[model samples]
Target: MRSSGVRSASALPCKVPYRIDIADPPDDALDLLIELGALDIEQLAGGLAAILPDSVQPEAVALALRSASITVSPAQGRDNDSVWLLRTAPLRAGGILVVPPGVDAPEGSLRLADSEAFGTGHHPTTALCLEVLAEIIAEDHPSSVLDVGTGSGILALAALLLGVDKATGIDIEPAALEAAAANARLNHLGRRLRLILGGPEAVEGAWPLVVANVLTAPLIEMAPMLVRRLGHRGRLILSGISTTLEAEVRQAYRHVGVNCTASQTRDGWIVLLGQASW
Candidate 1:
């Protein structure tokens, strides 16, 4: 396990309790906890923890309490497991991410949220997509965007926030769709963001920008359908692949004439950008 620095307000206290409030916790806050290096988590009256790192300062703890309305605080240790604490941070790319205290969203413009279907913007795959999305939108605003495997609907919502006229988010998981819808509402994007509970097979019509952030196998399988759904001069972004798997995904798209020579890698994940061959 990696060690994190710990800080606190006062000197040498044997024990202390801190509170972190998350009015609306995201669906995958628990998972985020683990990803952010919370060694342990528990739901007592209310709060969460990890083993305390020596670098923590009490003043920092107090500051967190003041700023957070939805708080997660440190509690008593149990069974030889110390419970250090964590809280949520606001994500800038179109929505707020509310995870338990100590869990942080990924760096960059991507925000964090609790979602079981993944793609909450904390994942490397999602971060790469956000950066690429910004570049693509900067060149020219896309009128419509289709985000397949929409996960928490972060991609579609981000597009809508970045001036896409309308966005369609598709996911096969009902829970994912529900989470996406909730996130849309949180960002006040309910009107512009449409959440569809299905796969690429259910998507109809062409879009100027289509993004699919899913695993290698599924991406390859859906390449044909995704290619068929892009308009002339439209762009497609594929993510959720590791650098090791990039060649496979690129070759799959190449077979359908959607060449993905342009790609980005972050934290071992790859995002491929391509355009439909006319």
Candidate 2:
């Protein structure tokens, strides 16, 4: 939670620093770190550790990373997890501005913008959703997608890129909506992407594909509403719960007549895919 020198806007795309310290490894340690945004594998020096940025000079950062020095290693091999890369084009949603990426938006394309909320295909929940979205597009090819609790609009944007006819995203945070709107514009998906601020209470409709990557308790509480918003044979993907809580989440969804058809786990986090029954 501390830094050495002042970092200008250009120096760090993220306003916040990306240093996470974990004392002891828990049963699901790595997953927890990923959830907290430790994407680049760094070294462990003494009991403290440093998670440097993806662009930080390894040798220099490694020395800085090691204070009292004991051990260290770069976090790597993240591709093993269920994840997909996305390419976004510049777009304008809600009349907000967006800038296109210097690099191409991945195969599936959509509007582009940035947000303050955590996700934009960088986190595990969003990553899992993208992979699942790709599979769904390949198989069922649903026409519409509803991303509930759409933090940073990554899920909904992925749907648009995958040829979804339309995508509607809803979130409770104003900042998140702003971010979603910005991302939509950045990807040039303003016409196909709609960003709304609020929860399920904010909108209603049956979408062929619905994804909610929120926490376990909230997901379970919103199960009824999510089920009601799915078209017949609609698919649902739920995540943000660790593997330890998979059974409980599955049971909760089952109680609401949602039968989980498949599941993917990364670093102990579970993403459950299900279908609406009745």
Off by over 4 Å in 2: 1-100, 104-114
Quality of model 1 by C-alpha lDDT: 0.67
Which 10 consecutive positions of candidate 1 have the poorest summed lDDT? 78-87
Evaluated at residue 193, the lDDT of candidate 1 is 85
Off by over 4 Å in 1: 1-48, 51-87, 91-113
lDDT tens readout by residue for model 2, 23-70: 333334444444544544333543334454544443343234332222
TM-score, model 2 to reference: 0.66
Per-candidate Cα RMSD to the true structure, in Å, reads 11.6, 10.8
lDDT of each model, Cα atoms only? 0.67, 0.65
Scored by lDDT, the top model is: 1
Instruction: Provide the TM-score for each candidate, comma-separated.
Output: 0.66, 0.66
Cα-based RMSD of candidate 2: 10.8
